[model samples]
Target chain A: MKKLIFIFVLLIFSFSYAYQFYGIPYLQQVNDFSLINQDGKKIKFSDFKGKYLLVFFGYTYCPDVCPTSMLRISDVLDELGDYKKYVKVLFISVDPERDTPKALKKFISFYDKTGKYIVGLTGKPEDIKKVAKQFRAFYQKVPVKNKEVGYLVDHSAYIYLVDPKGIIRMIYRPDNDDPKRIAEDIKQIIKMFGTGE
Target chain B: MKKFIIFLLTGFIFLAYGNEIIIKDPWIRAVPPSSKNTALFMTIVNKSDKQDTLISVKTDIAKIVMIHKTVEENGIMKMKHVDSLSIPPHSEVKLKPGGLHIMIMGLKRPIKEGEEVKINLFFKNSGNIEILAPVLRR
Candidate 1:
């Protein structure tokens, strides 16, 4: 009886602490879309093949959220240092009207300096809508009167972590703490069930 | 140490508690060439014992004052009104670009480029903090 009770207590303690480990696991992962990169190279998500994708959506006109969030992502990857060997970040633009293949390329370089390069993609608004819908991301334009023809874009702030097979392993909610922590979380996921010992 | 903190907190229950409740990093992006609406952001740290409220804000540039939060619904960013913001003791509330931000509506006149806006922040504790937001075309 004493041995059984001790085993039960250990089981309960492990369950509570071990489950909240990495990021959020989502229902569906985004796959298969042809979008233009910053280099004007027409590419598809399938091209990435076998790396973890930290997928995010926004436009160049976004005043705060996009830049701040992208900056944070850059910081996270910088903290990752060499672990970037296992990671690739994909940035999709919701505003394709102005974010041309040329602009998308320019905008990304402004933020991410690593040159591992953030894939900046844009397509027809309809195509962009389909890509975002697949991943359960949302974006809407708030128009102002003659406000430079560009207003504001609001979209979901989910940093999706996908596995080697393009399956989403987890989701990161909107957080502005340390980018390095995000890198650690990605490593933790990749190292799951493996020998961190 | 835990018991000591609990006892100390229980003893200070009047007038004020902690020394926080003030917002930090309050700023807005530089307005566009033809735009008048500018946003303000900061962190509200409440270190005092009593609960404080951010009642209103005053600026020499705008005729109307409003509090707003930007929320993402179905992927679209929506800006809406926020009533009085509460500042609790020992905790900090951040007013950032995508989160809770102050909306300066209806400019008194054109906030000329390279000028500055003096913002007067008022709290329920009757304490005031002023910050200068440079108006540049960033």
Candidate 2:
């Protein structure tokens, strides 16, 4: 009886410490789409086949939340350092109309100092909308009264962690957005997939 | 140890103000030209024995600068403009990314890193505190 009780307590402890994914898993494959990179080169999602892709959707005009999220991810990548070779960062522009390929390049480079691991992607409006819908991301433009201020786009903030097979394994929310935690989660995913271990 | 260094730095930085009300490490987040709004963050320490209220903030580069708080609503983050913020006696209030912040709207120019911007902060009893905030990538 004591041995069984000990085993039960150990199981409960492990379950409590296990990481939970906030997104749907194994439900559907991420939609394939062609988007122009910062250099105007056309690329597809499957191009990132062997490495983990950290996909984030936001625009350059976003001031606070978007930059903070990007910075957090960049910090994670920075912490990974040499192990960063096993991962890639994808920044998708939801506001394609305003965020041109050239502007996206400059915007992403600002956050990523070395400009090595991050790829900024933008395409036509319909394509962006289609991809966002596939990922269950929401973005809407709201008009503001100020002329200089123009309008603001309210977008759903989520960092999707895609496995080596282009399957999203987990979703990160803004509430628990920490660089250390994200880096730890990525390491865990890489270990589970047995691709980068 | 970090907090202690920050406290010492805050003391040294605010020595010119006679330690009445101190602001430590105030910085503005740099934004692109297309962005209409940006945020400012800092640590406000009330060295006085009485509580104080931050009434308003003004910057010439921005047409409208207001105090805003970021609150989570049903898992979606939303920003609400606030009229004022209070700093208790001998306590520090941090204006950070996911919490209270100063919002700058209608930007005349892009907030670039390595540049310093001036802002005038109004307090109910402490009077006006003019601060020079450096633009940093947050």
Q: Pick the candidate with the highest DockQ.
A: 2
Model 1: reference contacts kept, as a fraction = 0.22
- What fraction of native interface contacts does model 2 preserve? 0.31
Estimate, for each residue in A1-197, the C-alpha lDDT of model 2 and write its tens digit. 67754664454346436865333233235867889999999999988888888889988876578878988888889777666889889999988987888898888887776777899999999988988888888877866556666666677888888877776766788766778777877776566556642
The local distance difference test score of model 2 is 0.79
What is the DockQ score of candidate 2, to 2 decimals?
0.28
Please give, for residues B1-138, the per-residue lDDT of candidate 1 as tens digits.
Answer: 999988877766544443345556556555433333566777878887667788888887776667778776643456666878887766788887667888775565656555657898888784787877665432
The alpha-carbon deviation from the true structure for residue B53 of candidate 1, after best TM-score superposition, in angstroms, is 12
TM-score of predicted model 2? 0.78
TM-scores of the candidates in the order shown: 0.63, 0.78
Docking class of 2: acceptable
Give a tens-digit lDDT track for model 1, residues A1-197. 67754664464346438645345544354578887887878888888867777888877666456656777777777787667777788889988897887776666765565557477888889989998888788887776444433355667777787766666656777653357667877776656522211
Tell me the lDDT of candidate 1.
0.69
A-chain TM-score of every model:
0.82, 0.85
